[model samples]
Target: MSARTLGRARGPLKGSVSVPGDKSVGHRALLLGTLAEGTLSVRGLSAGQDVASTRRCLEAMGARFEDAPGHLRVLGVGLRGLKAPKAPLDCANSGTTMRLLMGVLSGQDFPATLAGDESLSRRPMERVAAPLRLMGSSIATTDGKPPVRVAGGTPLKGIRYALPVASAQVKSAVLLAGLYAQGETAVEDPFGTRDHTERMLAFLGHPGPLRSDKALTVPGDPSSAAFFAAAAALVPGSRLTLTRVLLNEGRLGFFTALKEMGARVSWERGGVHARETVGDVVVEHGPLKPLRLAASRVPGLVDEVPLLAVLCAFAEGESRLEGLAELRHKESDRLEGTAASLRALGAEARVEGEALVVVGPARWRGGRVETRGDHRIAMAFAVAALGGAGPVELSDAACAAVSYPSFFSDLEAAGA
Candidate 1:
């Protein structure tokens, strides 16, 4: 594992930075492009390892990609055009690739096995497998985990599924399977999750209400912008503007929580990108106030909880983050990882039931943070180091390349 030491901010993080394209969007774009009948042009695609994993897997299945300076032109072979791969499809550390691809492969006429790295292999694949099975896809798994084997040539039928949890991946998986089913398939989540897949499908002229008012152009990732927002909020006099970020309502819970915590966060409507909302976010350092986060909002900002925990460590008084049981199934046991990271940074944090309670305004004496090969955990702690009492050393710091390859360098450029 690679390690890096992060020092306290030399000055307020001040600058306008362009984060990479949305990872969720990038993944869906590539997958949908493969099923598209014509050449699909994708602008500002994420250049992360996770998206690369999706691209590699698709190429193995016969999709061709034409590269451009900052975009890609994918010549799709249409739905049902994917050929069976001779070898198992390795999704690497990307659960999105494995889960969503399961849906696509279910409708194929040839068998395919989806495998992943150790961390991803440990994540529950049965959530996706069980649903595809309902659609008549024969899938076998290693105790509900990775190495998911899908037996192709099985006919599929559409069924309405109410998600037990709000999972964009599972929902998208089912919907993708629906495309090849005999009838319409619908997924209903009690709490809405990121709808990138739905939006992209509609944009590509797939039949459904998932269509948008404008053409599809993927916006910058809000999750990536959260790290910079946290840095700006923690460092005095820090002001940062993030450009062309996805401002989808279902994905703004973290920013909402931050605003409630007294962070000076604001946004202006930029325009639409890829049928998704795009905007400019301005985050400035300010006095943070402690607040309670409802459990219901967890699904919307699930990916940002670790970053929020870092902010909570710096805020005055106790901050309770509820309804985070889903964190247990992520790249790591993020609930435990977040608490452990905070404790290592000299803050009071612990998991109580399904929630994480952090007693804060504690001195942030930075120390070693174990990332457990989770990219978000690595990046969150890196943000925490910006205002720490000492240098924070992150083990497996290179794991940030999974999502944001330029994270550390961009952080340094932001003066943190």
Candidate 2:
């Protein structure tokens, strides 16, 4: 669809929903599985275009998947077995796929070139390349951007690198390279990013002894659940529970920020595997208070800030988001997109430095918003449409297909 309007709920929303698998984990699972020995099976894989890109690319490198009874069975070739692709690896619009895959491919013994769509091509890959280069990986790129050439089989050695910011993509890139390095690879984040790559690695049988409350040391991801959590929060009468979402200390700050702002959320301990924590979440209708998100906490919710901005519109007071300057360089200039979307809904929003301050509890007037081909921006605005003062029509709604193809369907099933 070119564009579509989300009808406003007359009253409180009610129902149950099962959000698709975590996007971050979906990507890592596919990649790690390809590097693991024997058969690996994945459940709750996200049906998003980005994750699908990784799947297809992996298949092209000689990995295979089987549709099994309860999961997708992946036959991994282990490290050093991946063959060079016949053509350049096309990552579509996924920045994570390109950046992290570059690290993984860097240590291999084949020459691989990674390319992407226009958006991905513009994203900076130099940050990742810097550390990979330190590991002795020969990486050549056009001014730190995509269409990157990595001559694999470099003599890589482990290095301790401190991130200038909290970015899971960079962290995962280093960790993925560590898998091929001669020594241990450690990435220290000033502020924590998502831990999905770390968590999935632990689950898949490579649990690292990483410290928490300071810097996470694993190779997993948790940013993937932010979208699903937002959907649960927006669907008023909805009472959906996701099974086995990782709750690393650094990543839990988003939920803490939400609770401080007064969202009705609860957790239940579930089974565990591969030394990673697993649990369930139940969200229901409740009053939401506004929150002042500082720069210190920005790394925790970096990927979810767009969705949280949508939540701010439904809150009781003004919400301020700081340390969001990193967003300027994402798939799109998300800070501008977030502000523009809030304006479309009649909420007062402005950008100061790297912070986004949203004055709200203002009604979302059903107006058309351009997503600028950013998936997070599209999905976040879609959630806001549920609370619109009128029906909200989002242009470029197709972008949601990149990370959450069934987002609308899932929301509808939840009675939104």
Candidate 3:
């Protein structure tokens, strides 16, 4: 594994960063485009390895892709147009690609096996498999892990299912599979998820709200923007502008948490593009207080836990992240990994039940970061390195490419 050493910022991170396209939305766009009847051209798709994995898996199933200037034209094969892959589909490190594909493959008249890299292979797959099996797809995982095998072409009857956990990906999987099932397929998630898939379906002429425009322009990823936002929050005199970022209510948990922590954050809501709200956000460093982050807030900012954890370390009181059980199943045991990262950086952090507790303002004695091949972990610690007591060496920082390929470069540019 490769390593990189990041020092405390030369100065307060200043200037603007145009977020890469929202990967969660980017992933869905590619999947829905493949299922649509005609071509769907997407502009500003996230150039991340995870999204690339989705494209590769779809291509293996015979969906065609064409690259033009700033657009990816996906020639839709419709619902029944996907072909059987000659070999196992490799999803790399993207659980979104693997789990979502399980739903997409459920109705096909072919058997497909989805595999992933070592890290993804260890993450839970049965959460996606069990519900899929309930819908009549012959789906099985390797002892609740990856290498998910799906025998398609089963007669599916939809059932009203409740999500046991607040998982957008799982909800999306079941809903996607529901598209292939008979009868009315309904899912009730007590805690709602980002409605990208549902909106995409509607935009593509299904029965929903997102048909506001013909060409849907995906906005910048908030997840990627969180790193800089955290860095700016930690460093004094730091001010930054994040341009054209996704302002989805379901995805801005971090921003909400930031305001509660006393960060000077504001945004001008731009026009709605394809049912997604876009806006430019300005964040400035300010005094931060610890907030009791509850479980209900987890679904909105699940991906931003690492950055949040770092922020909590600099807060005056105890910051509790409730309902983080799902973090254990991510690319790494993220809850544990996050606590470990904080401890290395000289914070009092630990995991208690489903929540993570951090008592701060930490003594910022920096240390080495063990990424465990998790892209989020890698990126999170990189952000934590700024304004720390010493230099931080991150193992396998390249893992950030799984989501943000230019993470370090962008951080440098904005922090310069």
Candidate 4:
């Protein structure tokens, strides 16, 4: 148990921080770059271990890479050129690497097993497997979890799948498999999950002109930016600036929640990169209203739920987050972990059916936060501790390296 005790903030946090590149976009860009038949120069790839797992897996399958400051160059192996990996793909803690590559491996001519850490091995993988099977790919999960095995030479035929739930990973898996299918593979995503995969595919000329620029710049991650924003919102008189964050509509649920909670959240659209919108976001402290989150918005809000739950821990009303059953399958059972984190922060919180209801104006009387080895939860608790009345001891502070390696240091520099 790697622990860190965060002292209470004595003053409002004020600073500008550039978060790491968007992890979702970074994963898609690297994967698509592997399929493109030219040198793909990528700027600002995510430095987290999850994206590192993706890059390592791609390399094991014969993609070569060149490295330089703030840039990574992928020598394309082309769509049909990936060789059989020399060993089982070790995905570590990245569910994204295992899940998305399950789609990519399904269409390959060699057998592969997508394995991950114990945490990831327990996550549901059948959501991706069932659809890949429909497309004639042979996939077997360990009772609907990881160690997902993909058999070789299973010729694919694309089928339009209507998602039983809104999951961007599942959608991307099926679509990536669609690339090798005999017919058009289409996924009807009515819930509007982040389309980073679709956009990257289009930008890489999947069904359009193949003349895309070889260089791709990834936007800064919005999910990482949310923690500082939440801290600034909770700490009175605070102002924090986050530069070059991804501004996709699907990724803006946290911002919407922030706005409804009365934080002065503002942004300016700056430019576009790899078919993603980039912008600078500023968050300021204000009187917070309790968040009344609807169930329909769950898909877009999935990653931000914990951070929002932290905000709800201090907001001035009863905050109810519905349709969070998906939270149970993450690195931890976050639905319960979130309620627990709120309670630890001195708020009344519970799970009533599929909804998590938090009643706040939290007293910030902090104690030990149980992270359950999940990086996002660890980071959220760091924010909770930043605005706390007492120091918080996190159970797994080192887990933040899975995504945001510099999180604690950045928190300090940005006014912890």
Cα displacement (Å) at residue 140, model 4: 0.8
Candidate 1 Cα deviation (angstroms), residue 197:
1.1
Q: Which pairs in model 4 have colliding backbones? A: none
User: What is the total number of backbone clashes in candidate 2?
Assistant: 16
Each model's total of backbone clashes:
3, 16, 0, 0
lDDT of each: 0.89, 0.76, 0.88, 0.88
Candidate 3 lDDT by residue in tens digits, 1-416: 88998878889888899878999899988898888777777899889999999999999999998999888888888888899999999999999999999998998999999999998999998998988899999998998998999998798879788999888899999989887888878889899878888877877877532222245578999989888888888889999999999998898889989988999988889878877889998899998899798898898999999889988988999999899998999999999999998898789999999999999899887789899998898888887778673588898999999999988888888964
Instruction: Write down the TM-score of every candidate.
Output: 0.97, 0.90, 0.97, 0.98
Which residues of candidate 2, in runs, are more than 4 Å off?
204-244
Worst 10 residues of 1 by lDDT: 208-217
TM-score of 2: 0.90
What are the clashing pairs of model 1? 216-274, 217-273, 217-274
Model 1, residue 28: what's the lDDT? 90
Question: What is the Å distance of residue 35 in model 4 from its true position?
Answer: 1.1
Which window of 10 residues has the lowest lDDT sum in candidate 2? 211-220
- The reply for model 3, stretches above 4 Å from the true place, is 208-214
